[model samples]
Target: MATHFHKKPNLYPAHVQLKVSDLARSIEYYTTIIGFKVLQRTGSEAYLTADGQTILVSLIEIQNAQPLQRGFAGLYHLALLLPSRKDLGNIVQHFVNLNIRLGAADHDVSEALYLNDPDGNGIEIYIDRDESEWTWFDDGQVNMVTEQLNFQPILTAADGNWTGLPAETVMGHVHLSVANLDKSEQFYTNVLDYNVVTRYGTQALFVSTGKYHHHFGLNTWNSNNGQAPEENMVGLKSVTIVLKDEHYAEEVKQSLNANGFIVENFAEAPAYGGAQLFSTVDPNGLRILFTLDGE
Candidate 1:
């Protein structure tokens, strides 16, 4: 007789949600500075979209919400994908025009521009290079380092030329800060089964699936041993997940507990990065997640 055992599954976010205090202010900032399209809005609640994906970025009124706090578990950063460097360049121009406190960097495999959304949530707008252009380590970990981004050429040539380029894009990645790096890594890898691509000392862990670089990242840059964020401060609200199966979600939950993780999810959680997910917090008080894909 042969012994057999099941496998622990991986998770990807379904859709990450955010609760902003001021809908009108959020709408203008997202649509104008960040380039997110306004899908719809009602009173103090509003919904926004990036590249036609469906879900609501509910901007709840803070009047009745809890008081905001800094360094709490909430939205860290939502990565917006661009088709090409040219598109990234165009968007950078828009930000430059408005002086949106942008942070620019070239991560060998991708060019990124960082900023905060209206609600003070971190936002990253970026475009990736081809696989052939990626520099990998012996262990398949990409040699991702910040390089200086020269936005002169792309901006010099055009204005509002990003949408003209055609390429499939989605929310490419999300990076966060947690209270404990090891605990968070365990939840994301052992529990979520997200492959670790690299790390930055004891402070960070980078994980990913397939071959698209890191889709999830956690670090203790700040907020180590942090408490749960107050409802008031603008930060991560909820992360969406699509799963492959209920069994998969359940399997993942078992793994997290087995690995000594503290995970929280609604109903039955399934495995599948695009399908199922578990919205959680790490040691640094960051909003972390694992989601599966759709069936």
Candidate 2:
């Protein structure tokens, strides 16, 4: 197990380097279609920042790497982390002004707004509540539930409009779609050691670390006994997980392997605090990477 290869200076975290099929098409869809702004770009890659979180959809124009398969364990959703509930409130106001209706839910630990990207990747914009406020069961399990999220306060002029968020926000969590909820929860929470935030019978489950709400979510929405995706469909390119320190990152990479998650390679991602990213293929064969936070 290795660690991040770059320097991390802040708490702002995100999953960077999403490999895509067509760089131009993805860039167009993110910028024009999904309303993301282009932060930077090189020969074949483009970095886009949305609501203050900087993410790079790196278009590796190579004849290698595992091809994407739909119907399999693709991205369940990409959560755009907000600074606070006030930050989320402003975003709600933005949607209100645009006459866009969004799905709101309180997962006991977080307040979230659910929507979709241009390519059908589920997107969740959210803010975490105080850790002390997170409930726990008598058996020591974290308790989470879907509740009503109040948006009226945010829509008021007094709260402020959340149009262009600053760069302090992040990608707090990455949710996934699996064939079975229990099985997925076992892999993430039990195997990976994330505390169980909660579960919804057989439909879905949520997990997190240090009771900071949910760092991961799993659901059996469209894929009960799910099938892997095809090579042509555009879905979750890859998910980057940021860790705290080089030692911690190194620890996680080894833990993943000991837990039976087959690791492909250990690469030097100096862009991510010099963290060593160990990519793994799940039962559904989705590529998930672990890296470090960005500045």
Ten residues in a row with the worst lDDT in model 2?
A: 1-10
Across residues 88-136, which tens digit of lDDT does each residue of candidate 2 receive?
7666766667676578898767778888654456777777777668787
Q: TM-score, each model?
A: 0.79, 0.76
TM-score for candidate 1, residues paired by index = 0.79
Provide the global lDDT of candidate 1 against the true structure.
Answer: 0.62
Provide the global lDDT of candidate 2 against the true structure. 0.62
- The TM-score obtained by model 2 is 0.76
User: After superposition, which runs of candidate 2 have C-alpha atoms over 4 Å from their true positions?
Assistant: 1-13, 16-36, 50-71, 157-163, 246-250, 267-275, 292-295
**Tens-digit lDDT track of model 1 for 1-295:** 0001001122444355666777778777777776666556666666666645443244555665453454555556877766666677777777677777888888887778888765567878777777678877888787888889877865764457654212344566777756667777776676666788877778777887655568777766655666667656566655654445768767766875776667876467522123335655544454545554432
In candidate 2, clashing pairs total: 21
Identify the runs in model 1 with alpha carbons over 4 angstroms from their true place: 1-11, 56-58, 64-71, 156-159, 162-168, 257-295
